[model samples]
Target: MERTLVMGILNITPDSFADGGKFFSFENAIERAKEMISEGVDIIDVGGESTRPGAARVTEQEEIERVVPVVTELVSIGANVSIDTMRSKTAEAAIGAGAKYVNDVSGGLADEKMAKLISRNPNVQYVCMHWRGHSNQMQLKAEYEDVVKDVKKELDERVAQLLKSKVSSDQIILELA
Candidate 1:
């Protein structure tokens, strides 16, 4: 039987909707990751940026500074880690630091180079989540006639783009959220 894997979110951001800055500090983020592992989480998804509505985008350098160290610490502690980032640069940095997955909520749309980056790192897994737009403007773009159909179509398109970019099908994981 196939068992469901439990993935825990570890937001290393000051304005995360889930944790509300509880894990923003480096030490706090690492502690939370360890706690999640002890609590039976199979994967720790580390996100440095907040996607909360009307949230301003953080600089790439800031995001890298926020995420890479946490990912490295989690990997050193034998935890399976996924970098939750839209920018390819951040994902590349995290992967270099030993993260095994790239969780892009934008389905590779936010960053044009995301697919190419994932393609080059064939060992890394990519989470292509369905995103209508950025948090600040997504609600305004949510007027789909057939939500399910539209979402499916969009995801398919993304998968095709990824394939064209040479990212293997096995490396891609489709996420509705």
Candidate 2:
């Protein structure tokens, strides 16, 4: 039997719908990550941006500052860390800080450079999520005759694009959300 991997979310944003502001501080975020690891989480996904509907966008620098430290600390503690971000710059910073995965909710659509970044860092795993748009406007673009078929088609297109950008197929992980 295949073991199910449990990924715990460590949102260090002030506006996330779940646990917003709870882990905004460095100490709180580190504590939460430690708690998740102690609870048997296979991976801790660290996010600095709030993807909640109508959530305000944060600057790239701010996002880096928010997550890189926590990611570095988690990795030092021997926890597998995944950076939950759509921006390539933020992903790059997190990867530099020792994150092993990039959980991009935008599926490499939001930022044109994301695929290239992933390609450059061949060892880092990439989580490509099916996304219609940003959280604030994604609902408006959710109209589909057959949701499953449409999502599959979109994901296939994304995969093709990532391949064209030189991202290895083996490094890609598909996510329906």
Question: How well does candidate 2 match the true structure in TM-score terms?
Answer: 0.97
Please list the C-alpha lDDT of all candidates, in the order they appear. 0.93, 0.94
State in Å the error of residue 56, model 1.
0.9
What tens digits encode model 1's per-residue C-alpha lDDT throughout 27-124? 99988888889999999999988988888899999999999988988899899999999999999999999999999999999999999999999999
On a 0 to 100 scale, what is the lDDT of residue 66 in model 2?
Answer: 93
Candidate 1: residue 115 lDDT (0-100): 94
lDDT of 2 by residue, 55-81 (tens): 888999999999999999999989999
TM values, all candidates: 0.98, 0.97
lDDT of 1 at 50: 91
